[model samples]
Target: MLIKVNDRVEIIAGEYRSRPAKGADKVVQGKVLKVIPSTGKVVVEGVNKMYKHVKPSQRNPQGGRLIREAPIQMSNVMYVCNACGQRSRLGVKQLDSGVKVRFCKKCNADQGEIAPARKPAS
Candidate 1:
């Protein structure tokens, strides 16, 4: 999956896209905390929050509800380009130095290097 941890993303589809209140951003955007490539799901910060009920245990003297982010389908999110500050698709390209990097498809901005430059063969 192109989406990686720490990458900022915006929800393109699903109920999370709905604004929580007036004057809020139209889309839900957050940093990717985790990615499950096998299941095609990603856990984004501040999105898809779910409450987990916990009983009193040794770990917690007082039990309470904990809010956590739930995984959402990878297809529902679009990468937000760090350079252009816009949501766009990501593409991988190899530079002349042989470094593979992720780039934004909309503004053609380089996000960051995915792999180190390869040494030329003797």
Candidate 2:
């Protein structure tokens, strides 16, 4: 998938249709936490939230609950344009280094920058 980790994307057509990951078009600013290309799903930052119960721990010591972003499928999301501020499909372009970058289809601007997945230091 062209979308990398940390890429900001939006939901296109679904119950979340027309709404970005944050429940509005303004959700583009959210970063991509994970990408599931095989399933066409992307875990957007601070979006698609779900609750989780945690066992008693030193920090909680009371087994509380927490909310987390659930994975939204790629088909349900699209890349947002920084220039036009619209959620649109992406166009692939080859750079000088032969690296393909996803571009905004609406405004034809280069957008959706993502970082390579990094491993935490041991």
For TM-score, the strongest prediction is: 1
- Pairs clashing within candidate 2: 40-74, 41-73
lDDT string, candidate 2, 7-120, tens digits: 667655555444534433344346789988788788888666666799999998999787777787776667666678787677877666545566888888876444333444
Report the CA-based lDDT of candidate 2 relative to the real structure. 0.69
Note the Cα lDDT for every prediction shown: 0.86, 0.69
**Which 10-residue span in candidate 1 carries the lowest summed lDDT?**
18-27
Candidate 1 C-alpha lDDT tens digits along 1-122: 78889999999998767644233344478999999988999999888776779998899879998777779899999999998999988999999889999999999999898889988789
Provide the lDDT at 59 for model 1.
Answer: 92
Which parts of model 2 have CA positions greater than 4 angstroms off? 16-30, 112-122
Q: List the residue pairs that clash in candidate 1.
A: none
TM-score of each predicted structure versus truth:
0.81, 0.64
